[model samples]
Target: MATMEWIAACREELYALREELHRCPELSHQEYRTSALIEKQLRAWGIPVLDFHLETGVVAKISGGHSGKLLVLREDIDALPIQENTGLPFSSQVSGVCHACGHDIHTTALLGAARLLSEHRDQLHGDVLLVFQCAEESFDGAASMLAHGIFSAQTPNAVVGFHCAPQLQVGKVEISAGIREASCDSLTLTVVGKGGHGAHPDECIDPVVMSAGLLMQLQTLVSRRNKATDPVVLTFGEIHGGSAPNVIPDQVLLRGTLRTFDNRVRMAHLAALEDLCTGFCRALGGTCTVTVEKSLPPLINSPDICQQLLTSAQTVLGEDCLGSESAPSMGSDDFSCMLEACGNHGAQYLVGTGLENDPATRMGLHVAENIFPSQAIEPAAATLVQFALDYLN
Candidate 1:
């Protein structure tokens, strides 16, 4: 923190930018305004921008007059579909769209680093790619950009990304040497049954009842079937069935997600879930259709790259500001796609953004009550700038 006095002096501007971005939060592929703003800012700073095939993403490059190794610095710019309730002065103006996951902060920090690095380009030894990615909330934004030939121009030697961590206080960072986040896959189960009038006793095979039973049975997949030592999280967040009180619906839809670390465990869980859903519905004289949408894979950090980042982090922010070990999480991220696309030459870390000594201001990501302090912008932005400089040099 002491090594970034320059970033401290620019904190006010970064905070204002963060607030400005927070107010106009956009969801997934709909970050048109956000992308335009980022591109405009980079261009204004004399940095060259790339007009990628994406609808709402910007890829910019900064060369230090001599290119050696290319380093990619990524910051996801998409917000969630949640509504704002933080009551901040710069709360989201868009209804039913909020930056609950702190993408606003991530975007601001990247912009800040861009400005700082541009100012000191003469001191850089290589090229830096700024990836303001969109639709990260959709789990396919990175792939979209890649499909549009994001890497067709030049493959990066290393890719680095950061996410705001509310669990840790501002001025701290967590770098993982192994798996940081779990793989995610969504499952939609459609249970079909006979529709009937409420007065009928045996005329209908009730889907609502079968769905309820299936939900209970699905809970056992993790607890009973999977090994206790293995980690897996199965959550059913959406379930819809009949609409009327007197009539039973023919089909009930169940939407849920499965998160796991190991590939074998993830595949086994999917197979088990499909089998259980099908078997339960068939035995009940009904039919079930299961559809699985594959999402992000488990985010695994490259040990060598993480070690380099660890050393750089300790030098820039001090030892106390860097955690010894990152706590594994069931939460998943599409940044894993970037690492996989880069051929395992990339890594990610968490930048603490929670307020210090203010428990009331600290909350988990993607929650309605989540809110972070603006002062956190300085440390986060400074860390990004320093990391880029360290890696490039």
Candidate 2:
């Protein structure tokens, strides 16, 4: 079939898959229905589904007619906790749950690629592993799958995954090498102090005052302590203290995230945060406890894998679809855990998707309330399929 005709024939199926997933969005380890849907489809396509040691994920292997190196393609199958506001016909039906991050699109693209490749297995040169991972929204899923022996079982020479970008134009692919995303650390700080009556100013230690001071000092770390060239973001996303304005609460809780591209910078930021919190609480005659949870390492793409992706993308979608080297983002991805597990096995990782450059239209990461157009599905699937074919050949 001609390329246009082939894509057009598959378009409805792909969009239907995306819509189905979007309507019934699940979060993290709670993707039982989603996993089953993907598994059933792969089985129907005649692909061999492996026993996913991780309970909430699926891995389907398609070995080519001739023996060669193994290649892996991954798609995260978890949705965010945001409520849907897109108003699309296929918008999330589950209240307070949605695929705002485009995992539905990624999953659909990979499933389409898997079906196409399985049908053309006789023309392939090596084995292919289609990995549908869960709990990418959390820090545990990739590490959980890796620890359960998925990477060792497949032992692929290269692995690739992509995310949808609302900023990029429809039907285009954006590629970036090196540090594509930052390390993420979620921190919760509790400041304990003495409570007092609303009119008694001298009796209370005022933990709220200390918490505000600490928040201000945290921002200065990026501006004064870190190098100008280094990218670091310290955000205090939430704060909770007294219930009523008249009451001087005994404790205040502060929650935020830390993002950085450099390991040294990440460490430095953590150390500074600890010191600042401790010092500020002590000065205010209050006790403070800070907990860092769900931390993920920075995503660094392997050089060889990136080059292979560039070549594959250029061959399939032409040079105009490829993007220049862009700076690393402050976002975090669970794929970093997969890369860490397969790093010893000579695995290379890369990302391809759409990104829009307009700042006004861009929403917050993952938790935003919007729907990116479904036009990216075919192009992404085609690029991945062609890349796998090129690698296997």
RMSD values for the candidates in order, in angstroms, are 2.5, 3.5
Off by over 4 Å in 2: 1-9, 53-55, 122-125, 199-204, 323-326, 344-371
How accurate locally, in lDDT, is each candidate? 0.86, 0.79
Clashing pairs in 2: 167-355, 167-356, 168-355, 168-356
lDDT of 2 by residue, 148-245 (tens): 77877656777787877665665556666678888989999999998888788588888888888888877888899889998898888899999888
User: Runs in model 1 with CA error above 4 Å?
Assistant: 1-3, 324-326, 367-369
The TM-scores of all predictions, comma-separated, are 0.91, 0.86
lDDT of 1: 0.86
Q: Local error of candidate 2 at 148, Å?
A: 3.5
lDDT of 2: 0.79
Query: For candidate 2, what is the TM-score?
Result: 0.86
